[model samples]
Target chain A: MSNFSVAFRTTGSVTILALNGELDAHTAPELESAIQHCKNEGAYNIIVSGAQLDYISSAGLGVFMAFIEEFRTLGGDIKIAALQPKVFNVFDLLGFPLIFSIAETEEAAVEMFSKGTTHN
Target chain B: MTATIHTLAIPSATRYLKDVRRFILRHARKAQLPDDAIEALQLAVDEACTNIIEHAYGGSTKHKVDIAIIVDPTRVMVRIRDRGQPFDQQSYIAPNVVALTRQGQAGGLGVHIIRKLMDQVEYLSEGRTNEIRLTKYRTH
Candidate 1:
């Protein structure tokens, strides 16, 4: 069975990808494809809801790094939200909070996109 | 208590990363490490094994990565051994996260994360064997 899964939902123009389970080198490609799918479908504003995501490693973080620039160049952004403390610590360890928009909840991240804040 | 050593071996493949992480989690818990320390150990070992799979073994599943966890009263040491290309420790430089993202590069962050999370990291290359030892001291 798969150890990770990504589900897609939409809130207006923004597409929300709800990530669940462990995200490691083994499952990172799934997230990459999900983002690519969003971009291919012309959904730019994306919010990654990590409330159910139990774990994350550098490979998982790399997926975000690989795509964030492209989305920003296309006048869109990828915002992360509701990360567990453990997962957030990994992101923070790499100083990702300074680079990406991370909110305490998906609502807050979506609010940032609507307000057009450049960084968080 | 006293020090003890635990070992695990897996094929050098990304799909085995899950098994590696689980092995770390189970052993780290047995070592009585704190929650944060356990998390750090888990991630660090995962990064190391991922590096072994991708760089050392060049994504070849034919190779094997052997892992050993030495649990001491004050620290936990994870030693990973592989018979593949050795990592060039001297030539490695930490990547600028922003610059990497700006260039749309996704990799080159594993070693950095491993360094940041582990209290002590040592890389050894002898003959055809290369080993990386990641240590985390227990906090009380």
Candidate 2:
């Protein structure tokens, strides 16, 4: 219906982007730019709030696919949180459900960041 | 005998494409497309658009991409049109995934993945325009 809106704020050592709206081929660049911004800001940990994310396409997934290696190469961290079932299914199909550090809730995810838990 | 035409100026963002896949799937189902075939078609479309968004304009916001999905009883076809610089698909060598994965590198397998997932891939250049064709046959 409308373009995606993303806001970046610091939560301790993590950078959180309050992502809202659909994430498809058209809006994925915004998410990519947001992540890039975090990287440029030297954020080591990142959290993507997926509660408001209505849907995601393979192209949307590509944004993360293209960046994870670069982020890890720079010794940064990126993890997903609160994935919708339908959204999770897409990621699961792409073999990301096991690859990404996904949390059942944002609080738990943030806690994971604080404890530096294993991000598989 | 049902046909639908969807034309969208491909934005640099990717989240809006769920509807595009849904649009194609709708027709595919009516045409009796099998579940696995539909998944492959979805992946094929994604690979094509990812290439366009990343390379066609070199990620510049000023560039535009056009997509058309045509569906009928016999097959489903997706066409991606872009006015950006041309890409030579034939000379493009697909990255070796085994090596990349073994080395723990995260990317560069789009073309290879798409080739494995699709029945056919064709690229055409007309004037300054580039059009890619991805097709999968219907399964009754």
Winning model by DockQ: 1
* iRMSD for every model: 0.7, 4.8
Q: Count clashing residue pairs per candidate.
A: 0, 13
Score every model by TM-score: 0.97, 0.63
Q: Model 1 TM-score?
A: 0.97
Candidate achieving the largest TM-score = 1
B1-140 per-residue lDDT for model 2 (tens digits): 88655555656444435555675577666656787677667667766776776787776766666778777767777888988778887688766433443354544556665676677788899999999888886655
**Residue A32 lDDT (model 2):** 83
lDDT of 1 by residue, B37-81 (tens): 988888899999999999888888999999999999889999999
DockQ values, each candidate = 0.89, 0.17
Candidate 2 regions off by >4 Å? A7-15, A24-26, A36-43, A57-76, A89-99, B1-43, B53-67, B81-86, B95-113, B116-119, B124-130
